[model samples]
Each structure stands twice: as C-alpha cells, then as structure tokens.
Target: MTDLERDHSEPPDCLSIVSQVTNSTRAGKRERLAGAAVRVLHEQGVEKTTLADIARAADVPVGNVYYYFKTKDQLIEAAIEAHGHHLQTMLDELGRLAEPQDRLKALLRGWIGERDLTAQYGCPTGTLASELDKRDDGLDRAIAKVMGRLLAWVEEQFAAMGRTDAKELAVALFASYQGVALLTNTFRDPDLMATEGARLERWIDSLT
Candidate 1:
C-alpha cells in the first residue's frame, strides 16, 4: 500500500494519538538534525559534509534522517533558507533608516563585521549557493531568488543616489563584497573585508 493509504488505515482514535506523538517527536528531531547540519556545514562545508556525519552529530540513526528530510539537499536547502531569512530581516531593518547613504553604510558595516563568523564558516548562503550549483536546479533557483532580492535592494540604494546605471553599480558592489568575503574566508582574517569594504564605501561616497 502507499504510505498515505497506510497512514489512513489506522483507527481514528489511534491515528489521532499517533499524529500528535509523531508531530512532537518530529519537531524535536528536526530541530536537532537541522542544528547538526548547520554545524557540519559550517565546519566541513557543504561539499565535504556527509549524511553519516550529520546523523552521528545529531545522535540519530541514518534512516531516521530520511524520515524528516528526504535528502541531504533538502536539509541543506532548509538551512540556507533559514540563514537567508535572517539576513533578509537584517537588510530590511537597515533599509528602514532615514537616509539611503546611511542605509548603505550600515549594510557595509554589517557586512564587514560579519568577518567574525565568515572568517570561520564563510557566508552561509553564498557557500550553499556555490555547492547547490553543482547539485540541484531547484535549490539553485531558490538561492538565486534570495540573492536577486538583495541585489534589487542594493540597486534601489544606488538609484536613490541618482546613479543612472543603478543595476550595474549594484552588481559591481555585490561582486566586490563577495570577492572580499571569499578572501576573508580563505585567509581567516576579517581585516581583508574591512579594508576592501572601507575602500568601497569611500568610492560610494564619492559618487554622491
């Protein structure tokens, strides 16, 4: 029988109890698994991390992981989505500031300040996107959508500065940020990001 049919075959009262217990257990297990996956990805990166590693780190059976997440990519995608949402919220808060330049400055500062974490794990979404590019098209598209939103916001900031080619300028700024972030990750020093970020900000100020 199909999984859904099997699920529905249970007695109504038994099914209700099973559903509650299953949901509660699944919630706790998902949290642990997701947390373990994040730690593994942060430490070993998405390319090197394995299902066995995640299962061991989470103290769950390898089979149990499949019960929660259908595949490793699903787990990674969920983690990426969570991290992206966090960054989106932070960017939205920065976007709410009175002045566009101030908002841009805040973004720069925040980006540079992330060196503490980025120095170790790199940019979560960026790293995940790089790995996803090698694997699933759907995951890659989802990550691209998130990045597109950020790029659009940056373009809006550039437009506010009266830059005619806001889209191109925004792409340039993002490329610079990504390059510096990758460098910082490789070198294990936040200073590279700080130095380049300062230069970029100065250049932006000159444009205004």
Candidate 2:
C-alpha cells in the first residue's frame, strides 16, 4: 500500500498530534514574547515599554500576551529571569577556558563583539539593572542578584589567579566595563568600546 493508504488504514493518534502541536505553539509564543520583552526593555527601558510594544516586537497579538503574561510587571520579571539564565550560560561557557586570565579576556572579547549593540542600547544587563534600581521593588532586588552572580564569577576567576583581593578586582573590572558602556552609548561610538575592551584585556594580562 502507498504511505497515504497505510496511514488511513492505521488511523493515527490525531488527538495526540493535535495536543502536541498546540503545546509546542504555546511554548513558542511564550518564548518569542519573552525574547521580545528583553529587547524592548533593553532598548526602551522598562518604564517606557508597554505590553503592546512587546507584542508588536514579538509578532504575537496583544491579547495573546496576556494569556502568557498577565501584566507588564510579569513580562519584566520574565525578561529578568531570561537575562539571568543567559548570563549563567555565558559564565559557564567562559569557565571552560584553561587559564583564568584567558577566561577574563574572553569575556572582554565577547563584550567587544557586541560593541555596536552596546553603543546603541548600552550594556544590556547594566542598563536593565540601573533602570530597575529606580523601581525599588522586588525586581530591583532580582536584577541586583543577577549582577551579583556576575560579580561573584569574576571574583572567582581573580581568586583562581591567586589574587588575595579578588573581590576588589572584580568590582573594579565591572565598574570599568559599566563606565565604558555608558560612554559608548552616550557617544554612539562602538570603536570606543573596542579600544577600552582591549585596554581591559591588557590590564587582565598585567594582573596574571
């Protein structure tokens, strides 16, 4: 029998297939909405971005957004969690480098690679953290925790390099990065980020 005829004879689990497809579509919509929220929030700041803005960015209907995220705050929280997960994944990948100094340089390189975007929107995590800090709510604390994780990871790298002042070094590194990010955004100069990133890389080498 032909494949179509065999399928007709067998009568596949149509309900199961339909259920799986529906669930998959729901998951896709949610992920798209969350991703769009992150981009919009990063570019527009959380206070200025509305649910409709996110829906437009996601290509999901505004009504459908409520089906996934009940409120704007919910979407913001989801975006924060998404950023946290992404940060953890990046740190985990950087952790694979054999030399701690190489891992630090790799991070600077990764940031430099995104220089254009950073020039346009500022550092994604840093900008979000600064905006959320004004909220003085649970989200402020949530984003703070995300930044703290990054600081802790950098400190670990410095500690691994046999530096007794690992925490201080981590703070200084992040401060420099955040400062450069602000200036890059202010001037719309991606090259500035590249230059500063190289300087930071050299500084990292000097420490090692």
Q: Which candidate is the best by TM-score?
A: 2
1-208 in candidate 1: lDDT tens per residue?
1354454323222334455465644445665677788778877878788988998998889887787777788887766666667778998899789888888888999888888788887877677768778874587887787888888999999899888999999999998988888888999998888899999889888888
Write out the backbone clash pairs for model 1.
none
Estimate the lDDT of model 2: 0.86
lDDT of 2 by residue, 71-135 (tens): 77877888888889898999999999999999999999999999999999999999998888888
Q: Which ten-residue region of model 1 has the weakest summed lDDT? A: 7-16
- lDDT values, one for every candidate: 0.79, 0.86
Candidate 2: residue pairs that collide: none
Using lDDT as the measure, which candidate wins?
A: 2
TM-score for candidate 2, please give it: 0.87
Which segments of model 1 are wrong by more than 4 Å?
1-28, 55-62
